[model samples]
Target: MKPFYEKTIHTKPIFQGRMISLQVDEVELPNGQTSTREVVKHPGAVAVMPFTTDGRMVVVRQFRKPLEKEIYEIPAGKLEKGEDPASCALRELEEETGFAAESLQLVTSFYTSPGFADELLYIFEATGLTQGKVHPDEDEFVEAQLISLEEGLELMAAEQIHDAKTVFALMYWQNKRLKAQLGK
Candidate 1:
């Protein structure tokens, strides 16, 4: 079967910025009606789920301006123009958590918010961690912590970790671990 939403008409960017762009599009609905959809174009991003040798997960505590509060999340960053997701994942992991991974594997990729924004997030699993100096952006402020996988699950259950990307990555790993334990 074909998709329901079809792009009947689209207008190029009215304005562009470092992180996003404004675009207007006309789409045909499933009900055979036409409508306009304003979209925010993003350059996509990468999130890293770093695991220490001792089976601990590396998390970052940062104060998000939009939330106006410190939140715990996995290491993540937006991709620079012409940069690859894997490279971005490695760079962000080291920059945010002060740990470099010898092996980085792509876990999954998904859209952050499909309602209006076109932000695709690529998640990676980083292993073989080695300590380094955190080189966060000058405007960025964050604290890194290494928590056990069990502790991370507890944090999720306690509603302490609320970021969507972080939650998704943790749950994905958790499910994988459970399946492995059950010999499936």
Candidate 2:
């Protein structure tokens, strides 16, 4: 089967910014009509679900300028140019939460918003945690909170934690743990 949308023409790099770039493209639709799309290019990012030995999860409360409100989320950050996702995950976890993980396992990856942006997020499970000094960005205001896994789930159910990436990572962990217990 052939795809409905086919790229007929493309205008590359109308503008580029630190976080994203703009590309104008023309595509031929299934109905034999052409349309233009302004695609946003992103450098991808990483998010970490840090679990303490006792089964507590580390999260951060910070203000998101886009949301214009403070929200709780798992530690995450955008990848620097040419940086590995694992390195970015570890760095972001430590910088935001003052904890370092001895082992980080890649859980899954997903697009943040496939409809509009090409932002791919790599999710990781960080374990074997050790306390460290936080190295947050100068402009970043964050407070780290360690909550029980059960409490984290409750927060999600209560609508307190609304970040999509965080929810996805936590849910993935929950499902994995349940499967492990069932096998025991």
Per-residue lDDT of candidate 1, residues 31-109 (tens digit): 8888888888999999998988787889999888888777789999999989999999999999998998999999889
Off by over 4 Å in 2: 12-15
Q: What ranges in model 1 sit over 4 Å off?
A: 10-15
lDDT score of residue 59 within candidate 2? 94
Instruction: Report lDDT per candidate.
Output: 0.88, 0.88
**How large an RMSD does model 1 have?**
2.0
lDDT of 2 by residue, 1-184 (tens): 9777665665666889988998877877788888887788999999999988887889999988988878789999999999999999999999999999999999889999887689999999999999999989998999999987688888888877888997886777788789989994
Q: After superposition, how far is residue 47 of candidate 1 from its true place, in Å?
A: 0.7
How good is model 2 by TM-score? Answer: 0.90
Among the numbered candidates, top TM-score falls to 2
